[model samples]
Structure formats: C-alpha cells, structure tokens
Target: MPDGGPVIVGISRSTEKIREIVRKVADVDLNVLISGESGVGKELVARSLHYFSSRKKRPFIKVNCAALPGELIETELFGYEKGAFTGADKQKMGKFEAAADGSIFLDEIGEIPMSMQAKLLQVLQDQKFPRIGGHKEIDARARVIAATNRNLEAEILSGNFREDLYFRINTISIVVPPLRERPEDVEPLVYYFLDRLSKEHRLPKPDISPRLMKLLKGYHWPGNVRELENYLKRLLVLGESKELEAELEAAGDGWNSETDTASSQEAVIEEAAKEVLPNKNSREKQFPSLKEVRDKAVYRVERALIKQVLEETNWNRREAAKILKISYRALLYKLKDMNLTPH
Candidate 1:
C-alpha cells in the first residue's frame, strides 16, 4: 500500500482481506475485477487501487457503463471526431483519453451491451482503439478496473456475456461480502457515518442508544452500506428513535425468514402500515383515508423490497421470483402494479 492507508472502511475480516489483496496488487498493472452487490463500495476499492499505485498523480477517471445508453457507449468510451455523428459539434475526448497514464474505473461493467463488448475486449487486449469516424488508433495508457453486481459466469453460460472478455478482465478478482454477512462491522460503520454526516452538516454528533444500535445490527440491510448511511442520516435529521423503532417493527422479521408465504407477506405489510402511519382524522381531519395510507405504505415497502432482491440477483427476474417465493407471473404483476421497471 501507499504512504496513506486504505480508503476502505470497516474492521471485519472480509474487509481486511480485501485490503491485503489491494496492497499486494496495487503496484502491479494487471486488470482487476471487483464483484459485489450494489452500494457495497466497489468504486471506493477501485479508487484505493489507483491512489496507492505509482499512477496516483495521474488522472483517475470513472465511467458508469450502466448509465450510458447502448447507442452512445462506444462513442463515450472511444471519443468521436467533429463530424462523426448527426450532432457532432466539436471534438470530444472519451474516458480512455482522459485517463491517460492513470486509471479508469468502469462501474456496472456487465450492463454493457453485446454490440460493444468486442470493441471493449480489443482495447483490453491491444491497449489501443480508433475513435469513431477516425482511422488513427489511440493508445490506451490507463489501467482498467471493472466492477459489476452480476455473475459473469451465469451470463456467459446464457450467452449474454462474452467468455473471452470475462477472462481478460478477471486477471485478479475481489468479492466484497454483503453487510448482513459481517455483523462485526455494523457499529464501526454507524459511527463512521455519524461522524461524516455530522461534520458535513455542522451538527453535533448525537449518541446512539443501545436499543437503536441493536435494531440496526439485527436488520438485514438489503441495500447494503448505502441504505444504512441513508437511514442514519434520516435518524440524525429527524432526531427520533421512536419513529425508527416503529418502522422497523412494522417491517417485521420476514426479511430473514426463509418460509415467507403470500399471506404472511401481506400480513407483515399490513402490520407495518398500522405501526408506521398515523390513523386518519388524527391531525384535524386533513389526512387521507386509512385504506389509502396503508395502500401507499405497502406500495413503497413492496417496491423497495422487490428492487433490492432484483439487484441482489443481478436483475434476473426468474431468480428473484424464486428467492421472493412468488410465482413468475405474480412478480411480473406486482412490478407492473407498482409501475416499477428495470433500468
């Protein structure tokens, strides 16, 4: 590792092991693949690799492969000439060019479309690619670090991903375990978030009650660290432990239950709504009906849970259905009912 310590936070064995691997490979220029669920800080690990390496002084550019549309990904990665496309106003430099002699972090690499996979493979193999509408090949001097929540092996077996490209990027792989799997890091992360949020917001650091801490540790964070951070910020802003407790109680223990049936899921949602929402006419008769409020709460909770499971399964609806213990048709119906579509 470099003079400064690792950028990753946490004292869990899994996190420490990841740091050990990073230290061993930081100086070497081999391509790296990081696999983890969404919001598990894959980008942070990628940054640590670049910062601790010899190329710390150079540019550290990042590209979100999932954010760009399929039609524009190639041009975004390889740049374009002034007259390359319909609206080519001026010369544009892509991520590879901006990251010269440094590192380029490709987040959500599995989302890249099949049409552009071969081009990306060429750049990985040859370290050079021609810009759109330009014959001259540009040298790729940056180290490539790719991360994805998807299982590329399954994708390859299904023919959704290229096998050769998988080998090229899997030179060194790091798997970041989920937060629920490592309970020891929960308290450290809570304090870390509290300190950071307090400093940023210029607020005094509030002490966490043992009860709150216990509930936090007990809950299965489907959204991982990002979700925990958001929840902490909410707690700080609201300054109400009772509200947090009520919501958690309403959410129930179905999150960890392996035998969650349809009726049980519905009952859990109803119980959560009653606990979290105030009864109608409690606030001088300006509130929505109790049924409407319950419906809304149930919708929000269901949407969140479904979305979390989808992310955990890498957007594989069939797999998600199996985990959720719902039929494929029912899952599709619920998605449509909630107006939730995969990005």
Candidate 2:
C-alpha cells in the first residue's frame, strides 16, 4: 500500500498487482472499471486512485448507482435547477459539478438503467452535461471510476447495459479477487483489521492462537475481507469463542456458503465438526497425523474453491484465472494437478 492513501494490506501477488496498477494509472485521467464481488473493497481501490491522482486536492464524490432510482438518476448526477421537479426548492449542484477536477465514483455502475446509460455515455464522451430544466452546460471534469459486481458483458448481451457506455467507462479495468482465492493475504489482513478495530473500539488486541490463525487462513471467506473484518470485530468485542472457532472450521471443511445466509454458518460448522473433528469417544481409533490432516484439508478446500470459481465463470479458464488471481499458466497447471475439468 502507498502512503497517504487507502491501505490495501496484502502480500499476495494479486494485491501487489492491484497496487502496481494503481500506481501506473493513478495519475492518468481515464475511466477505470473495478469489478469484484460485494464487500471486496472496490471503494478502497477507487479512493486510492483518487488519493494518488493529480486531482487529490479536489473533491471525491461517490454515487451508489444501485441506490438511486431510474427517474432520479439523471438529476442526481447532473443536478437540477430550482423548480426542476415537484420537490425542487432551490439551486443544487450535481455530482459532476461538485466533483470538479476530482473523481466521481459510480458504484454499481451496471445497475444504471439503460435510458440513463446513454446519458452517462454522452457525459463521458462530451465531457459536459446540462442541469435538468436548465440550458447552461457544465463541464464534466471529474475522473470517472466505476465499479460493479454484475457481469456487465452479460448485461450488454441481454440488452440491459449499453455496449458503448461499457467501453466508455472501462478504459482501464481492474479485477479484485475474492478472499478465498488469496489465502496468503489472510494473516496480514487479520492483523491489520485487529489493530484498526482495536483502536477504533478502544480495546486491546486479543491474542490469536496459532490454531485459530491457521483456521482463519484455511477458511473460505464468503464475504471476503469484509467478512474477515466483521469476524475480527466480533472477536474484539467477544474475545475468542468456541462458536467462532466452529464457524471458521465450517469454512475450512469445504462448505461454500453464501454470505446472505445467517444460519448457514452455524449449521455447516456443526456438521463439518461432526465429520472432520476427531471423536473423543472412539478409544480404539487411530487419528490421522496433524500434517496429514492439514494437507487433506488444504487439498479439499482448494479443489472446491477452484471448481466453484470455474463454474461461476462458465469454465472460462482465463477469466477464472483472473478471478483466482493466478497466472493463466498456473491455473492450467493447477487444473491438471487437481484433475479438475468443466462440469
């Protein structure tokens, strides 16, 4: 991570690549499209771009496109004159005008309605737009950095997103990989979150046992770094608990749970513990060595994660590789080693 900017704490190759891309393009005034799963720190990347850019002194406006209704989007971005609508009472500055020479981040860019997409495209192309119910055109000088979780190419093919608009906002694209694909970054992220969250909450950092740390690194984080941070927050508030250990153990057991399900964490963790944890009652049973257990667990989780990513990408190895943050050749080697194929 660079100084005086959003700190993307990671030693993983993927994190370094993101840092490299930010350094190279931070000063370049081009639209950057950052695509990743929700809570994967897309906004952090956007902020880092703005912080390091030439427009660092100017405003950095953020508009959640998904949060705005279709009817109000146009007026929201370009602003409106007094009495432009029924609720209009006074002159208002639009995001573009307010952004000035800074950057305007359009979060969830794919959710913008088709009608509004054309208008946005025009603004990006012409570098100027008019206020609603006003003739005066304002220059759109802000750098545009858009992010989306949706597959915009699919949206375009389905006639929901404008291809021209896609090209306009996607002059440079950066893909932030999910946490499961970058387990190496887990330790640093855990420490970083612990330190920050402790200071924020005025609590001392709790000692994380090596066993628990191993579980955290091995677990497949469904919510990515956001999920990790939340878990750390709970840890900070509640200290280490058996419940938390069980929940993390479930992820290590190869459960691909969705982030939306609250109960899934408990259910799967309980089930996984029953299956994987050694039973104390079996006196005659010879348990596997710790090394064997760890190797097997890693193999199982890695296979499941790779398969899931590949399936999500519809067997597009290149896309899967990008999402996995591994080189194309490395992904090929892994596929071969793991004996994985398109389902």
Candidate 2 local Cα displacement, residue 259, angstroms: 14
Residue-by-residue lDDT tens digits, candidate 2, 1-343: 3355679889999999999999999999989999999888899999999998889989999999999999788888999999988888988889999999999999999999989998898889899988998889999999999999999999999999999999999999999999878989999999999998898899999999999999998887779899999999999999879999988887666564454334544454455445565787998877988887677666666666778778878999999999889999999999999999874
TM-score of every candidate relative to the true structure:
0.73, 0.74
Off by over 4 Å in 2: 1-3, 254-343
Q: Clashing residue pairs in candidate 1, if any?
A: none
Question: Which model scores highest in lDDT?
Answer: 2
| Candidate 1: residue 254 lDDT (0-100) | 65
- lDDT (0 to 1) per candidate: 0.86, 0.88
TM-score winner: 2
Q: How many clashing residue pairs are found in candidate 2?
A: 0
Tens digits of lDDT, candidate 1, 45-149: 998999889998998899999999887888889999889988998988889998999999989899999888988998889999888888888999899899999
Over all chains combined, what TM-score does candidate 2 have? 0.74
